[model samples]
Target: MNTIFLLNKTKDPTLSEWYERKINDELRALGIKDVHCKAVSSEPMALEITHPLVLICSSSILRDTYSYQSAEQVYAPHAKILAIIVHEKVKFFRHRFTNLQFSPLRFIYNPHRMPLRELIFHLLSQLDIDLEVRR
Candidate 1:
């Protein structure tokens, strides 16, 4: 099964929990039984995950906590990395992450602006997962 590792380092714990619930709920609604979604706060735990993975974390997590060099050491090329950048910081984050060697690093600006379904679709698409392939 495909696994989505959400590396939440957001300021609001409630918002983080809500995001996790939304992703899992949406996956079920989409009949995507083969994919599993989980939220992780530890960087070591996040790095240890090697399944068909999708990472969701905030810009602050990337910028202030983890560096691209450190991430490149642990992150596989096939893994789809998504950064949730605050609305005002999108430009800075875009400029920073865009130049990385990673091919498909997606950025979600102001996540609260979009519906949960839209977020789920975008994330699942990045993994190139076939929802029909059930376990």
Candidate 2:
């Protein structure tokens, strides 16, 4: 089965939990049973993440470079990653520099610009996961 690792290493606990639940609920509602979604606050040391789809859902991830680096070290070199910008308060300079550090891995979603459901669908499509939406 395909797996999704939702990484949220921010200071906000509630936001982390909310993202976890929301993503899981959205995937469940989509009738996507083949993919397993797991949320983690920090780098998972115990679990062996085999080329899973990773989602970085933290507002301050750009500010905390260590977390990003740690994640890079943990996941497979070819693993697909998507960073979701939960907040837009990151300074211009910081955002630019931090983005440079996150080379190759692009920020795919900004809640202010697009809905989470849209992002999810886009990701699923990219993975070639075909499923009929249940009304």
Who wins the lDDT comparison?
Answer: 2
Clashes of each: 0, 0
Report RMSD for candidate 1: 6.0
For candidate 2, the TM-score is: 0.60
Kindly list the per-residue Cα lDDT of model 1 for residues 53-117, writing each as its tens digit: 44444445445434434443434333436544242234455444332322234445355444556
Candidate 1: residue 133 lDDT (0-100): 28
Q: Can you tell me which runs of candidate 2 are displaced by over 4 Å?
A: 44-48, 57-79, 88-107, 132-135
* Residue 86 alpha-carbon offset, candidate 1, angstroms: 4.7
Supply the global lDDT for candidate 2.
Answer: 0.56
Cα lDDT for residue 108, candidate 1: 50
TM-score of each: 0.58, 0.60
Give the distance in Å from residue 135's predicted Cα in candidate 1 to where it truly belongs: 24
Question: Positional deviation of 31 in candidate 2, in angstroms?
Answer: 2.4
